[model samples]
Each structure stands twice: as structure tokens, then as C-alpha cells.
Target: MVVSCGLLTANKERVPLKGIEVEVEVKDHVAVVVYTQHYENKEDKAIEAVFVFPLPGDAAVCHFSAKIGQTEIVAEVKEKQEAREEYDDALSSGQQAFLLEESDQSPDIFSLNVGSLPPGESASIRLEYVTELAVEADSGLRFCLPVVLNPRYQPQGSEGHGVKVTAVPASLVPYSLSFSARVSSPREVLKVDSKCSLEPLQYLNKEKTQAVVKLAAGHKFDRDIELFIYYKNAHQPAAVVEAGKAFATPGTIIGDPVMMLSVYPEFSQEVMSSITTSGEFVFLLDRSGSMDGARISSARDTLLLLLKSLPVGCYFNIYSFGSSFEPIFQNSIEYNETTLEKAQKKVEEMRADMGGTEILKPLNHIYSQPCIPGQPRQSAEGTDGHVTVTYTLAGHSFHDKLSFPLQPTEDTGLTVHRLGARTLIRCLETEKGEEVKKKVVEVSVQSGVSSSFTSFIAVNKTSREAIHGPLLQRRIPGVWSRSCYSLSQQAVVPMMLSHSMAKASRMQSHGMARACSMQSHAMAPAAMLQGNTLGVKAKPESLSVMDKVKHLFRPESKCSDDPVPTPAILKHPDSLLQLVSLQKASGCWELNPALAAALNKTSKELEQPKPPKVNGNVWATVLALVWLHAFKLDAQIEWKLLAQKAVSWLTAQNAPSMTECIMAGNTLLGSNVQKDALGL
Candidate 1:
């Protein structure tokens, strides 16, 4: 029989759980889930049970309770410090007590302390939470119950209050979960989809506005439980109004109806481009250890999406932060193809091995950089420390200007609109002891409607009796993937080779022979050798259509050849050639960890293989300029000759568009660049 199991600790003791049952109810787009965990102690002595788990980042917990046979005890919400004191007191007094709270560091992680359970005793803990269903990329309502909790990297200078998740292989987790969901919406239910096995959805009404689905039997908590609910006309704007609790006093905030509005605004591409035609786009990434696993992967994927969608002629830079901050470029640079290729290569090699998430430093640096005229600066940050970072950014001067251009304005506009609306509400009130703007900002930041700030509390006031026993305090571990943590240890892929007059390897395949035969050696203006490794002599050959296409994109092809120089306004051709030589087959450069340490410098300090501590993407851009300087004036024959092919190849390429590379480089440099520009 499958059983719920806590993380495998260094001690090797496994806390076996009985079962997990979840009941969910939906009203329009909001879903309220009641998670019940059953635990039984088989050990000979009394024990404390701790369970670290993941919930939706925005989940608002409203109820917590523990049941012991005939007696039922409920928990009450109090100030964090006070709640901790109460929980500790009950545990010391040997009374059966339970405590639940969100992690101050990460919204997605939470820990439960089940204290004072005697030997052979069993108890049921139930937690109820409410959250708005997120809209998926396909316009469906996405509901996810996370079973896999990855380790979160704590940033330097952050309070070490983030949950410490113990990881194990997925196959070793012994938890059995049974989940059933009821979905209700104003629109007719169209369908439901899930990665997990699910029973066919059942409609509750003929109108098809409501439906229910259940996980198939014999399921384990191996991965997140995900469900997508599609509705008719999902793209249409919509709103839902929920009445306040009946017990709440009338005319108060709790008594008022909670109104949620959704809007999808569209603007012409031209208008959108005109507003952000050229500007600085800064990306701040958190490579702290906690970002290991799916979090980093998701961040990388989001970075790629944003890079591809950038306007053709914008300047951008990346900063990643852990214990410190590093910027890819000392300042933002213009985007183009060759630079983009290098950036993409660097980004693809990023790992969440950076020590901590000290993000403020990078933010300060990014802000300190002088803004260019007619080019606005937009910063986006991505991290698991949502609350801490959001609170920090909310207080920044640039917070108002930082925004997602591609996202619907209403999403952002509403937050500002609501801030204004709340300001109006305060102005309407007779009380004016507090500064009006300050009060409004506080209300907007600390709204009860925000699950981030407030929590639900239920107390069993009827029970006055206390029990006697020694309550064992246990710290429960979440399910972490062992394989993900070791991703940094994987071997790096090797770079492909391309050079002038290089002898082709024995043609095991016809494709290689064709490629070699098509090289256009006769087009070279001179045979110059920078080094034995750089010079290549070859027979003249006809270039095929494919060969020309390959020649245009491949920088390595022109390594030793010098073509006729043309007047160019762009920097040293040799340095540019060296940078091109560093590109891997994936079109990006990566840090050689060994090389960095051998040079007695931190990876961030090393920056590039050449001069000026600019990281990979920036290194490539600087080298391009170095080459451009040679061709800018025809007076320098040797420099121009060497750089001519390099410059031509560089010009033919489009603007750098690989955001992931910028992100990776920034991360390596300990800089803060947000991923929110893509609304990720």
C-alpha cells in the first residue's frame, strides 16, 4: 500500500504518512481547497511531525484544524511572533497542538508543526485555502496542486526564514493522494485537461456551467497535480462578485462584496513598438540555490520568450544576483545578431548554483546607470522571494515605470486604478489623522484582499482544558528532486569547429563531404596568419547555395581569411575574431569553471577570456567594436584586412535577440534583472 512519506533526512528515519484527501469547491474563477492530511505514529515514543509543502504562491489560507478522535481543536491567527510563542507554549505543556504559517521568504512554501502526538496515536489536520484560478497560455483556467517542492535559494542579506526542503528521488516518495475538484463558472464548461490521470469530468447541471473531476485511484504525489479548465468564450472580458460572510458586520470591508474584474486589451503592433522603440531592458535573475529545479528552468524559458519578442533596435543588459550582483555589460548595449548569438550561448549554460539572492545591490547598480535619452529603462525581476522582492521593488522610484509592454495594460492599470480607487475611498472617509497618500499606499500594499499579507484564523474557544505530555517537535521536509540538484555537475557539451582551410574529417557521411566541397576559398583577398592555429590554407572551390548560407552565419569560417576592406563606421577585427572563435555549437559562450579558478579570480571577476571584465555577451559586443575600429578607417591596412570578413559577417547578422544569454551572464555576474518584462 502506498503511504505518505516525509523527506529522507541524514538520520535515515522516514516519517510515514497515512493518506491525503483534498476537496475543492469553485465559484466562478476562484477555487477554495480543503487539504486533509492523516498521520499515525507507529514508533514507540511520542513524536512531533513536520511537513513542508508547496501551495499556489497566491493562496490565502482561511482555516486550520486538528482532530483527535472525539475532540477537535482549531488554530487562530495571531502576529507571527505571538503565534510562535503560543505554539511553543502548548508544545512545552504537552497539549496536542498544531501550527501552520506561510514562509516569510517564499510564498509557495509552508511548514506545518504537529506537536505532542503520543505513540500509536493518529490525527487528522485540515487546511482550507482560497485562490484565484490563473489563466493559462491557452486561455483556460489553470489549477495546480504542487506536490514537488524544489529547494529555494535564499539571497544574501535575506532573513534565513525560507523553508529548508529535503529532497529525494520521485520514486521514493510514499504519499498517496486522492483529489476531487468541482469547477463552477459563469460561462459554460467546455472541457478539462490534466497531465495526471483523471476520471472523465461530470457535469452537475444541464446548463453546463458547473462540473467535477477526480484523480484516478492509486495515485501518488510524484509530481504536481495540474488541471486546466476551459470555458466557452474564454477570451471575453469577465467579472465576478462574491458576497461577504453573513457573520461579518455590514458596512465594513469584510462585509462588502468582493468584486474581481478581468480584461484583455489589445493595441496595434505599430503603436506598441512606437511607445518602446528604443530603451534599456534590464533583466534581474535569482540564481540562489533555492532556485534549483523547475524554478530556474521556467525562468530560463521565460527569458528566451522575452528576448525573441524584443523590438529590433533596443539596448538591453542583464544582471543576476546571489551573494552579490554582476552586470553582463557595465552598461546596456544595442541589440544585434552576433551579440545575440553569444548571449544565447551564455544563457543556455546557466545553473542555479549562485549562493544567495542579494538582489538589492544589483537594483542599485542598474538604477545608478545613467539613462539614455529617447531610450526608456525598464527593469524586470524574477525570484521565488516574491513577497520580499515585491515589497522592495514597490518602494523603488522606478517601480512606477517598470512594466510589461506586451501584457494587457488593464492588468497593470487595474492595480494602479485600484490604488487610486482606494485613495478615493480614504478621501471619502471622515478620518484624516494619517497622510492621505501614505494611507492609500499602505492600504494598497497591505490590502486584506491580498493573501500575501493576511491569513485565515479559526479558534476552538470552547476547550479550556490542557493536557500533560512531552511534545516532540519535528521539522517536516518537502519532496525535492535529487536529479535536479545535480544538474550543475553534468558535463558541458563541446563546441563545434569551423576554420579556413581546415582539413575535413574522413567523410563517414555524404553531408560532411558536400559541406567541405562547397567552401569558396578563391574569394579570399590575402592569406594572413595570426597564429599557427589561426591560419588555414585551402584549394579554391565553388560555393553551393547551402554553403553560402552557412558561410554567412558561421563566424569561424573567416577566422584566417582577409577580404577587401570597405569603409565602416564600427572597432579591433582580431579581438572580434577571437570572440567568434569562442562560440560553441549552441551559439553562446560559457564560463570554464576550471579556468576562472586557475586565474585566481571569481567567475564574475573574470568576465571574459579577454580584456575588460565584461561577461560573455558583452565580451562578444566589445570584440565586435574592436574589429569595427580596424575597418572604420582604411589607413590601417593589416587591421582592416583581418577584420574585413569579420565585419561583413557581423553586419549580415541581425541584432542580438537571445535574452537567456543576458540572463545567464547577469546571473553569473550577480546582477539583478527581472524576468517580469515577459509577464513570467
Candidate 2:
């Protein structure tokens, strides 16, 4: 601590010289405390109090208590860096707060911490810094290190101090965040052989298509059960429909079902050491009129932050959709230093234009010529979906009203045509510069951070790069992967994509659709008539008619493996999926896998068990009934007997705590079980 005392004091006979101000600073384990004496009167020596941050553990605050003459002061001591900002709204002595990077500031975010003075007179200030620790792996080749918050103290004198952290294997405390789903169950734990349909749903899109999940457990504490809604789609599931509302948008289709769920059985400590990063994603922004103002601004900020965080060589592209969907041509502008600058500038200059949200235009454009356009589709699914989707492109737009409708087909390659009107949206260009498509488009959910892909691509795996978590890959093919930093809840996809896809009808209006289409006209091959096939994967089990659905929304998963659409997608509620009607295509897409297994069985005793009666909840009983009808309930396994037991289990269910067993169970058990158990 340095303190200077000016020597100029009055000698009796002569005029006194000035006494300059001096400051005193205290250094501690996590913080450096300081006080300055400011001259109330220059004649009285000017004493200044200044706290210089010396610790590295990023802390944004400090504490202070002082007595400078009659000035009775009680104020929070702050690091010089933090004290510089204005905050009349801040707390007086406790809870001093400040933004590490102001919203207006182009912040290169690092870590930040804050501290407080001891609550009594003549006491030392207490300070704390946030830091994270994880296990390390030194396999022959260096695995990427996780990016952890380094704890350091920035006390006026102490530089940020590294925290002594021990990595303790941890598990995410299971949390409960659920709404009453109104699910049902059939059968009890030990008795009841009748097939009682237990249903939790009120009315879903008026489809009346319900599931009768069959379930059973090994024992009471034995929750080895898989209770996902397993069913067959006969042919194909319908396209998405705008059945519910989210984010205050009217007639907006949900990116996921109300019953949709994402479950992380347990928060793994592994999340701390490895880079659980999603694959390299290219964000295709919709700067259409509907995405004006707050949406655009938020997107700009979000994208910039994401660009700043991406891994080096992680590819991406930024395209806008308005009157026309176009990329800033490197032919006209390069991807060089100047080009990136111009690209950012171009983004700043962007204003949502009123134009058509053409489905085929952007996909065809980016696919035919990628920005990094070098890679080819990994499989036939990728290639065909791209080609066919590129064909189904339409310039029509829809807004909140009639935003989407079920599509029988898109003009390009082949598509399952199963999703609804509102489910489709634009594609993200990838490292290969091709449009990364999705089987299940990842729409925005209100969790996780957006990727700073632009920045990620610039990063080199230097040792200094924080060993954060594992870099998650493209679980499947899709451009935009999950975001990393938003710390909301579980990691979630961005909501903007689905929101825009649902609003396509806005551009489809007669007034703007034609003109927008004319401005970006390109010949499409929708004119060529070619019969499309579902590109069925035979080696793998065929996708049950309900490939990605469950009895109710349970988070057995989130699909980052789906294909994304090109150009702009037409949004509607139920994305119409086409079932290859055996009569129409002269092809049987598939039969329910379970039923097939049952049918293929040759055991005489196991053949076609008698139909059972219902007993408990509507969902379980109904599901049991359906399974019996479909697979004819095998008798060897005593499916009817099992169905009866399932009904009895539910009938006696006043209050049961099988949730944990169900959640962790690997069998047919469920969290909030709706329907289950047809013995065999």
C-alpha cells in the first residue's frame, strides 16, 4: 500500500505551500481495498481514495467504510475499473452491481466477480470470485480442454488469484418442472388382467389418434421401464399444424409438442471437463419484414456474440430473407479481413424488406453454390431430401393468419412429407458450404446460448484455451446446432427459425408475393414429374409410423439429427406428412415393428391372445386395447395377463412415487405414465 504525505505545511512566519492528495490501498487474499482523501478545501490537504484492481479472479466490486472528518460516509468500495461507471440505481452498501460489458460496449466477455466489506466497524472486507474445475485427459493426442470460469481476485492490489479447486464428480440434482399433463395409466402393480384404456389427453387437433402404451416394471424399486409413447403411423405422420401458441404469436405452431419433452436423466459432471459442443452450424437469418426491429436487433447482438465464440474452422454462413433471400457474394465481397468487416457492416445496414419468403430459392442457391461449398451430402437421405426440398420451394408467404398448411409434397428430391405446414424453415449453410438439412428441424426453445460460431472458427486449440466441455457434434446432419452460453435451462435450439417458418404466409399475400418472386426468379424443376420414395432405411429398423413421437412429450431426446429446409419454409400447424398409401404408391412403406415381430413369431401358444377388457385410466387402457388389436396380444408372454395387471396398478393408484424409477428405468416405465402393459 502506498500513501504519500505532501510536505507543504505552514512554517509560522511564511505562507504555506499546498499539500497534494494521497491514497491508501489494502491488499487481501481476494481483493485490494483502498481509500482516497479528496480535499474538501485545497487548504486542507487533499486526500484521495483509489482502489486499484490487482487480482485476476475477475471481480467487479469492492467494499469500503471510512471517516474523513465530519463526513460520515458509508459506501461500497469498488475496484477503480468498476467505480468509473455511473450507477445511481445501485445499492448503497450491499449488493453493489455492475455489468462487466455494457450492452452498448462491444464486449470481449471474460469472467467477473464482486465483493463486500465485513458488516462491522474495523473489519476486513470479504470478497469472492467464481471459478470452475474439471478432470483432465492427457490421451496421446490432446483432447480439447473445457472452457471453465477461472476464479481470480482483483483486489486493488491483488491480481486475479487462481482458485484452488478440486474437481468432484457430481450429478445434476434431478429437478421437477412439469405441468399437469392429464396422462393416464392402466393396470395395478400385481392384479387386474382387463385392458382398461387410460388416456390423459383431452383433445389433440381433433385427430382422436391416441396411444395405448404397454408398460410393466421388474419390481417396486425396479423402474427399468421405457414409457415413451410408441406407436405406428400406418403410413406417415401428418405435417405439422399451427395448433398452439408460443411467445405471444397468434396461430403460431410450437417447435415442439406441448407434450414435447427433453430429459437429462442426471446432470453429469462430465459436462464440466469436455467440450459438449454441438456441430458447426451456419445460421441462416430471416431478415424478412416480420422479423423487423426487436427481432433483428436481438438477432444481430446474438449472432455477433455467437460469432465471437465459435471454434476455429467451424464453418457458417449468414443470409437474410426479405423481399429477396441473398448472400453477400464474395464474388463481389471476399471472406477476407475486409470481407468479414464488410459483411458485418452489411448486417448492420440490414433492414427487413417486404418480399416473398420463397422456399426453394435459397436452398437451390446455396446448394448449387456453397460459400465454403466443398462437401457433399454424407448419405442418400441428405442428398435426396436436399434435391427434393429444393424443388418444393414456393415464394408464397403466410403470416399469423393461415401461416402454414399440410403439404402433400415439395417439388425437389424425396421427402417423408410427414411434418406439418409450420414445421419447415430455412437451412443453415455448413463447413462444407452446403445447406445442412434436418429430419427434425431444430426450432428455437427458450434455453441455452447461441453459438459464437464466427469466433469459434477463429480459435486455435491452444493450451490457454479453457478446458471447458466436450465439443458436441452434429448428432445427425443439420446446420444450426445447439447454443452454448445462455444458461437458461437445458440447452435449447433457437426459436426464431420456427417463428419465421410459421409466418411465411405474410409474404404469400397477393400484394407482395408475385413481386418478391419476380425479383429473385429462378427456374425450378417442380415441373418435372418424378415419383418420390421415402428413402426407407432397411438395414436399420424402419421408422415406426411414428418415428419421432412418444405417448406424451418425454425428453428421451432432442433431435439435432433432422434435416433443415432451404429457401424459406411455409409455416402451418400440423406439418403434413404423406403416408405412401399402399394403393397409391403400390408400396407398403412399413408395418409397425412390434406388430411385425409378433406376426413373425411362430409359437402356437403365443399366437393371438384373447382381447381383454379395460379397467384403469383411459390412456393406458386404450393403448393396451390398441396393442392387443394391432399385435393380437401374444399369449406365451401372457400379454392379456400383463394388460390386466397394468390396469389393476392404475386402479389402485391413489399416490405413487414411481417417477424416479420410471425416469431412470430402461424398460417400458414412464415418468408421468399415460398408458401401458399388454402383458406380452
Predictions in order: lDDT: 0.48, 0.23
Displacement of residue 55 (Cα, Å) in model 2 is: 48
| TM-score of each prediction | 0.49, 0.21
Estimate, for each residue in 1-680, the C-alpha lDDT of model 1 and write its tens digit.
Answer: 75535554545555646678999887655677899998887666778788878776546555678888877887665545556677677655556667777665444566777776777888899887766555443456667787776444322343444345555566655566889999887789999899899999999999999999999986655667888889886644454334444565555444444444443222233443233235556666667775565446535543443343344456666666667767667777776665555555565666778786555576567657787775655324542111111111111221111122222222211222222223233222212334643443334233332222223233333333444455454544456643332211111111111212121111101110111111111111111111011112111111111222232233322121223232121011222222333333222334443223322244445553343333444344333333234222221211222233333233344335335534643444344434332111
Off by over 4 Å in 2: 1-179, 182-282, 331-340, 370-680
Candidate 2 on 386-463: residue-level lDDT in tens?
Answer: 100111112222221112233222321111111111112111211112232221122211111111111100101111
Model 2, residue 533: what's the lDDT? 8
Best by TM-score: 1
Give me the runs in candidate 1 sitting further than 4 Å from their true place: 1-16, 153-169, 245-255, 265-469, 473-477, 484-680
Superposed Cα deviation of residue 577, candidate 2 (Å) = 39
